[model samples]
Target: MAERELDPTVGALRGEDVEDRDWERVQPRRISDADWKRFEGYAAEILRAMGMPLDTPGTAKTPGRFLSALFDSTEGYEGDAKLVTAFPTECRGGPDCEISQVVEGPIPFYSLCEHHAFPFFGHAFIGYVAHEHIIGISKLTRLVRMFARRFTVQERMGSEITNALSRILQAHGVALYLEAVHLCTQMRGVRESEQTTRTTFWRGNYEATPALREEFLAIAGAHTNGHRS
Candidate 1:
């Protein structure tokens, strides 16, 4: 198991802002039986090599559980990021049609550490300004989860999420912040536990304009350090 915590401040949107909003949960596709069988066999072999007695009642289901978790962490498991059906929403852009809207909150995520295959889990903060379109708050959260539930580096994950949103929504700007505690670092190497690794990605106005970036950080309550777009 991995230590994953979302800061209470992640979803700091005002009550009225989220109320009346239809937040639909994404349904996960089922993993195939063939894949499950293969993974179970492999996991059992690894456990046997690790000196685990698989015949024991308590241990019998460990391999299946481990395999299930590994696949579930990726959400789609054998597929790509789930397709998001976004609806048309009114944007309150000014005369120039430059609208600044931000959806900030904590979204739970977990991933495998490429270095050691241990799990790293934490929260991600996302906010964006709109040009012609504004995404629903629920979609933003789903997008973050879709990207986070895959095997990738935190830096790349942040970047990928930003790019995906920008392309899908064609927004004027986008910003993302990820903070996670890696089990690989906690249980091995230097064994540091208290510190967290942070990664950020920004694009369009949030990248070219310092004020916009700062405002986003202020809203998301993110520390502006080690930013990568």
Candidate 2:
């Protein structure tokens, strides 16, 4: 079977205007005061239709609060400006030059499932072999959160992160692993409380070399097992 090509537009870190990007269909739009008022009214009506009492003082503002929280949670639509920057690699050429995987892990993230709008959250482990540059350590977390904050599926999220890292670093390899507990399953449908979803993505050399993939997995597993080094 042929390997799938990574979406070149998956990560907009190159300062590309993402308004028309297919991967990020939910473009940021102006939400005026009138829009908020209209949304709050709709929320209240929806709650009432669902038999939620909103007349009580405690519940009176629930609709507005709900709207605010929902919008706040999906703020990934507004891309992070800090993600656009990268620093030159410290790896020196010559006999001393040593290229290795750069891994950042246990990045806790919360995301709403596009299927149900219920939250599925967990930690992400990202590994990449830099070519000419390296991203800031903190930006890894932002990268994960960028996709997570949207209504997304785990598979797509992993792909976007992998592709984004590859694009930014022009990396030789990129690997991403995500393990999340979906409330959609726990709170509805089969109600499998203990079930968690795991997804992985590999690109470039990470996809070509099994040992490289395994090495990345080992590091991620060690951290997950609480043996951080």
Candidate 3:
């Protein structure tokens, strides 16, 4: 990945002090207030046409709350990804340190399905071979969130995570395995339950070395299955 200045917003997201309430204040950078008003109008019209009473207890606040939640999930539209922070590698043992493949999380993420405008959500497991630099594990989770909180397909999201990790950490290899339950598939169309969409992506040494790739997959697979049950 091409080097760039670390983003402060990314750091804020990683901070323990940052709370869920803070997200309510975020506004979409691309959409204007006028545009939001227009959307609100259209949303209300749709609800009315669908025989939903705007004044009903169940449907009240749906227009505003729905759009707010949508934009909140896709906060990357407001430049969240650019805020990622990178720090120097540290080892207690000093100059001579072990280079290892770091496996991190079943970091839970939710994303909008670009095709149906629904949602697909699940855990993401990331593994990368840290060459000279090791990224903070919390930052890795934040990185996953930054990419996932947007309109995307599961396959594209996996590729984005792999590429971002490779570039951000300058890792020798990177792999991401994402398994998600897509609402587009579950709530409509075939409407199948207990079905999942899995996507895998890798680059650098992971592509060059078969063993490295297989090991990461094996470990990630175990983690995925454990979470599923």
Scored by TM-score, the top model is 2
User: In candidate 2, which residue pairs get closer than 3 Å at backbone N, Cα or C atoms, i.e. clash?
Assistant: none
- Which candidate number has the best lDDT? 2
Compute the lDDT of residue 149 as modeled in candidate 2.
90
Task: Compute the lDDT of residue 143 as modeled in candidate 2.
Answer: 82
**Per-residue lDDT of model 1, residues 1-229, tens digit only:** 1111111112223464242111223455676899889889999999999999999989999999988788778762333333444444555566334436575667767887666778888878887776545667676767776666776778867776776666555566888878888887777657645678878788877778787777776766643232322
The better candidate by lDDT, 2 or 3, is 2
TM-scores for candidates 1 onward, in order? 0.73, 0.83, 0.79
Better model by TM-score: candidate 2 vs candidate 3: 2
User: Which lDDT tens digits does candidate 3 get at residues 107-133?
Assistant: 899999899888899988888776556
Candidate 2: TM-score?
A: 0.83
Tell me the whole-model lDDT of each prediction, alpha carbons only.
0.67, 0.77, 0.72
Worst 10 residues of 1 by lDDT: 1-10
Model 2 clash tally, residue pairs? 0
